[model samples]
Target: MKLGKSVNFTTILLLMFNMLLTSCGKNDDGSGPSPIPEPGDGVVYLPVVVHVVHNGEGLGEGPNLSEQQILRQIEILNEDYRRKLGTRGFNDHPDGGDAQIEFVLAKKTPDGEQTNGINRIDASQENVPDLGYNQNHYAQYAYWNPEAYINIWTTPLPESSMCLALGNATGPKTDLPGTEHLSIPGPNDADGIMINWIHFGESNIDCHARFGRTLTHEMGHFLGLLHTWGSGDCETNDYCDDTPPVDEHVYGNVPFVGCAGEEVMIGNYMNYSHDEVMNIFTNDQIQRMHYVLKHHPGRNALLTSPAL
Candidate 1:
């Protein structure tokens, strides 16, 4: 996408120079400068176990996503997070960087039993309630240790909604001072992500958001990245220096110049853009996620947890 017509040539030249310096760091071996970890240094593997909550729905029906569909979502997460080379959304933007994170299906349950990493539950609560589905109620069907596995509950939204949200996730609670204890694996109801079945895969549900980007966006929140527009306006910051601050969320692929005269990063995963348009994650965002993996009590455990 065109960033903007107002970019200064001198600034671009300076950026290029900085990149050259970064790529030419001194090395004792004299073989050459070490490759800078623009994306990151080491890969962080996260184990995921998806809980398919279906209300007596058979395979390939309703919220009961088939195993293949679930695997497809996992593949998308790995591709997007790693920014795999030649991927459809891959770009050469200087600020954009691979997150160096991969999601794998767990091979064992928390109780040291063999499993396929998928838990199927036929619960009535899988059906959306009149007041919208309750995450805690849905989680009752199947919930593993949140510290070791990313729990994803897929279900349908209430039928009476004015608008449909593909998914929602609970942001990391580590920021709360008194709530630090609650960050660890426990019986907390608000610990995992709840996704609309249609948006979980490349299905023919919501065309605008059917390409599995909803989970990618929600995962950003689970890892502590805020909306690119912060809470509301351009005045508030999402805490990432590379993500340009916008007056508000940019939906679809619309070009929007922020108050600071910089073009808004509509393609950022954290934005409300459509699946096809949302792709890049700024370097600052990668750094923030790494910090969460290293420091957050609830999330740090996943870094070393064995997928098996």
Candidate 2:
């Protein structure tokens, strides 16, 4: 079912205003999220379906990564989200939070048939410049009900683009009013993360983003976390109080201090920093994600639906 545009717009504005007010308060030291949520709730499990699209390449070749590689990516996601001890980037920060979200590969299809959650498709539309269009085209080859499962498309992205991004995603549409039409089912339901195959797993390719943190970054977007700098300037907040506000994205290993002279959270998962240095989501980010999963339309169904 579609949402009324007017009602949706009003609701989103109200929610965003409330979030802004709630997140504006800072501690005496100028640290964020004045009052963080106490961690005691049960974990939220999300079923996942990975679509590996390749250019007629056989398994374990090109974009068609091995099943083991995909599993490794899932393991990385679990470690990042759950903050498992001994994981590469896990650390102890008072504001750093464990999202308490677990992602499991689907064991059953939408038709109730037992199968691995991985879908390998021999298609040539693997590399595209426009991520939204690419997801729509690839979904025609293989797609399940998006409401019940988190769909991740792994393919090669165009290397020639002037501005290269390891991955991109369509955040929850409920937050964008006029864009509700984009969520319609069929070939246009662009509601998942699209990652460059080379950046999918830790060992798939050797690049600056080889540590599998690209997916971690995109997953933050998928779960409604914006860049620490927000959409534009320091004035534009990401609705998280704990994160220091920067003027723009800080790429590579360059040290960045916030616009207001606060120490930037260079290691935040939402930043464009190198994978090895990117970790930790603030308490407010965790709260925002939990709110989306429980309150956003179509998203809430995943918590209860058995299909994937």
Candidate 3:
């Protein structure tokens, strides 16, 4: 479905506004060179497919988000994945962190077709309500060759649905590392990542006053970023040193003095608050993600011999 020019313009405005609200001005506190280790041979780009389920209830019947909004979300993810633009409350260099990993929207498919690496699917109530469509229903569309793409699904629902929707504001379940693998949450975490409207869209969690930062946070999860504050305990860590150690997830109002006495990188996109703060990924996190790409089943071929 095509959107009118006017609708497109409005979507852009909303996206920019939300970004401004969530983005932080650049700060050199963590200034340093990119720490991402060089790839082995070929350049690997992560291709992502976005699936927006309509629920077939039509607008307003469920979550009233539109296609324009969904597209805006994709655009936002691309920008964040490419460049680190800091804002008032966010910083790319909390302790002066630098990263080298980059993401380019795939220009060609494994078969060599022009592609931006994004897909959309509209599902009817062919399945149950909470059950919705099987993950495989949409997975098929994104499975064009898993060695080359990352798939993301977004949907709208009541407040309760948002809570049960897996990776909401709570972040990924870490205590049960294998738990994420056992039941596999929504369905087949190995296949793709699923995000909910209240948590997935370009909008931020109202409780957190964050705008559009959740995707940044979640995409970190997709790219193998753990919570900055570490898993469930203060001792356990996300492995990034630039980020100060904190006890747990920060949602809604940020603490004035917590964060284990370390200067809070509240504006980093990884932080909980959506305010114009926390924009940068630390050099350490960059290394971790780069390391993760080394093993992610979908990323192997891209690193060795890619279509590019």
Q: Which candidate comes out best when scored by TM-score?
A: 1
- Residue-level lDDT of model 1, residues 1-308, one tens digit each, is 24357878887787789867866765766567654232246887788888887777788777777999999888888878988877645767899988888888898898888888888888764453343465576666777888889888887545333127677777665553222312233454547887877788776653688788889988888887887877556665687778888867678877689868999888899888988887799999898888777778778887666653
**Clashing residue pairs found in predicted model 1:** none
Superposed by TM-score, candidate 2 places the C-alpha of residue 280 at a distance from the truth, in angstroms, of: 0.5
Question: Model 3: runs farther than 4 Å from truth?
Answer: 1-44, 57-68, 83-118, 128-144, 159-190, 198-210, 253-255, 302-308
Candidates arranged by lDDT, highest first = 1, 2, 3
Q: Relative to the unseen true structure, what is the Cα RMSD of model 3?
A: 15.6
lDDT digits (tens) for residues 26-54 of candidate 2: 67675774442222366877888998888
TM-scores vs. true structure, each candidate: 0.78, 0.77, 0.62
TM-score of 1: 0.78
Error of 3 at 289 (Å): 0.5
lDDT of 3 by residue, 60-160 (tens): 33454565665666555555544445423234444444343344445576677776654444555434434344445455434555455555665545677
Ranking by TM-score: 1, 2, 3
* Range of the 10 consecutive residues with the lowest summed lDDT in candidate 2: 176-185
In order of listing, the candidates' clash counts read 0, 1, 29
How displaced is residue 239 in candidate 1, in Å?
A: 0.9
For model 2, the local distance difference test gives 0.75
User: For residue 125, what is the lDDT in candidate 1?
Assistant: 49
| Of 1 and 2, the candidate ranking higher by lDDT | 1
Where is the poorest 10-residue window by lDDT in model 1?
176-185
Q: What TM-score does candidate 2 reach?
A: 0.77
